[model samples]
Target: MTVLALEPQPLAFRVRPQADECFDSWIDRVAAAHETTRPALFRHLGLEAAIASLDLARGTCGLSNEQYFAVYQVIGQLAWAVEIEVQQIEGTFLNVEASVVLPRRQRRYVCPLCWQQALRDGRAPIIRKEWILRMSWRCQVHALPLCALPVADGAMSEQAVGSWLSGAVARAESLRWKLGAHPRLVEWNAEGVDTLVRASRKRFKGEKKAYVDRFQANLFHFAHDRIAMLALAHSRVGKATWGFERLVALELPGRPGREVMTLQPPKLPPRRWRISKGSLRPGSHDAGVLDLVLAYAHLRVRRDA
Candidate 1:
C-alpha cells in the first residue's frame, strides 16, 4: 500500500509581521486574522508539538545559538512564514552578564499616541527595540514618556506587547527548558536591593574596561560633583539596542550625555549606594552605574582642559 504526502496549506489570510515586531505579537495576529486557534494552525503546519509549550510573549527568545537551531530546525519554515526573523529575537534579554541573572519579572509600557496611530492605520502595535534601552523612556515621535500599563488586567499595549513592558523579561519557562541554555543564567537580586553587585567584563583589553571596572567597584559610593567632572575624557558611545521604526520617530545618534552626570539620588542610600532597578532603560541600574563612570572620565577632562 502506498501513502500520500499531505501538502502544506497556506494561511487563510496573510498579515506580514511588522518590522522588529515581536514573536508573540506575530503569532497572535496571524492566529486571530485567520480566525483560528494557535493549536489548529500549528497542527496545519505539522508543528503542533514542536513549539508545543512555547508561549509567544516578549523577551521569550533569549536563546543560545544551539537553542535557536534546535527550535528552528524543528519548526522549519513555518516560523519564517509568520515573518519571525531568527537572528534578532534575543533583542529583549537586557543584561548579558555571566555573573548575574536578576529575578524574572513582568513589566508593561506603551506610547499611547503611537498605538492610536497604529489603530488608525490598521497595523498591530509593536514593542520596538529602542523601548528596551535603560536610558530610553520617552517616545521621540510622541514626545511623551512611555506610560506604564497594568500587566494583568489592562489592555494589551500592542499585539502581545502588553505582556512584556520592560522589554527585558526572560522568554518562556518552557523555552528555557527545551533550549541548550548556558549554566550561569539564574534569577537573583543582590543584597537588600542596595548592595554592591559585580560582574567581570566578558570582553577586555581597552581603557573602557578599566573605567568600567572602576565604576562597578564604587557603585555604592557616588559623588555627583566628581562624576560630572569625569564625563569628558573618553567618548565611549552607547547606541540604542534597536533601530528606529518607520513612521514613528527620526532615529538620532545618541551618545553619553554630559547632563547624566548631574543625576540626583532618589533617596540617600542607607550607607549603601547601590543602583535602583527600574523599568525604563535609562533608569535601569546599568545606566546608573555607567552614568557615574562616564561622569568620572568627564571630570578629568575638565580639570585639565
Candidate 2:
C-alpha cells in the first residue's frame, strides 16, 4: 500500500508574536502551544529541508543577502502554517546591520523582571528583540541590566528554554535581595543607546535624507572601529573571564569621554565571560565587548548631534 504525504496545514492553536518578539522566541512559543517540539513543528510545516539551507551558525541577527533570502523563504512557510501574513513574521527578524553588534548565539540575554512579570500576567515569557542586541545590556522597562544565560549553540526545546528562564529569574531575585539592588554589572545609559539605535532605523526623505544617511554611516563606522579596538585590547589582556567592569577599569587606550565613563570601574574580580559558540566574522566581537563599544558610540552620536 502506498502512503500519501500530508500537506502543511494551519495550526489549530496558533500563538501570535508578542510585541518586539524574536522570531525564534515566537517559534518556541508556537511549538509549546501545540504541545510539540520545535523540530517536530518544523517537520510538520515541511521546513526541515529549508532549515538545511540556512546557516544557523551565523545566527538570526546578521544574515547575508543569500541567507536573508533563505530565511525569508522559511518565514513564508511558517507564516502560512500559522495563518499569519509574511510581513508579520518578518517584523520579528533583526532589521539592522547587526552582525557586528550582536552575540553569535543571540537570544542569550533575558530581563529577569520582564520574564517574571510575564509569568505573573499569565503570558509565556518571550525573548524580546531588543534583548538580543549587544547594545541593549539593560532592560528599558525594568531599568535593570539583563541577565546572561549560558548560550545554547543550537536550537533548544521550548520546555528546556522555559525551565532555564525560570532558574535564571530565581537567581536574579536572590541576587537582588542580597545586593539590596540590581548589581551594577556594567555602567551605561541604556535609554540613550536604545534611542540612538531607534533613530538609526528611521528613514528621512528628500533634503534631510542625505544628512541622515551620512550620520548613520558615520555612526556605524565609529561603532565598528571602537568595537574592534576594544576586542583587540580584550584579547591582549589574555583573560577571557574579564568582565566589562574590569576592562573599563584598565583605562584602556582611546577610551570615550568622561561623561560616559564617570563611574570608577568596580574592582570586582574577573568573572568568567562565556564566548558564544560560532565563527564570528572579522571585526565582529563578543557581546560583552560590544556593550562598551555601543555605549561609546552613543556618546559620539550625542556629541556630534
Q: How would you encode candidate 2's per-residue C-alpha lDDT over 42-96 as one tens digit per residue? A: 7887776556444342235566687777666777888788788877776676556
- Tens digit per residue, CA lDDT, model 1, 1-305: 99999976656565665664544455656777777766777777666455645533323346567656655553445545554454544432233332222111322344656765776797777655334322223354644445444455533446465344333222212111222221211101111011221112344335434434433322211122221112211112111100111111223246535444343312311332122234322323223544454444344334333
Task: State the C-alpha lDDT per candidate.
Answer: 0.39, 0.53
User: In angstroms, how far off is 90's CA in candidate 1?
Assistant: 9.3
Each candidate: RMSD to true structure? 17.4, 13.4
Q: Which candidate number maximizes TM-score?
A: 2
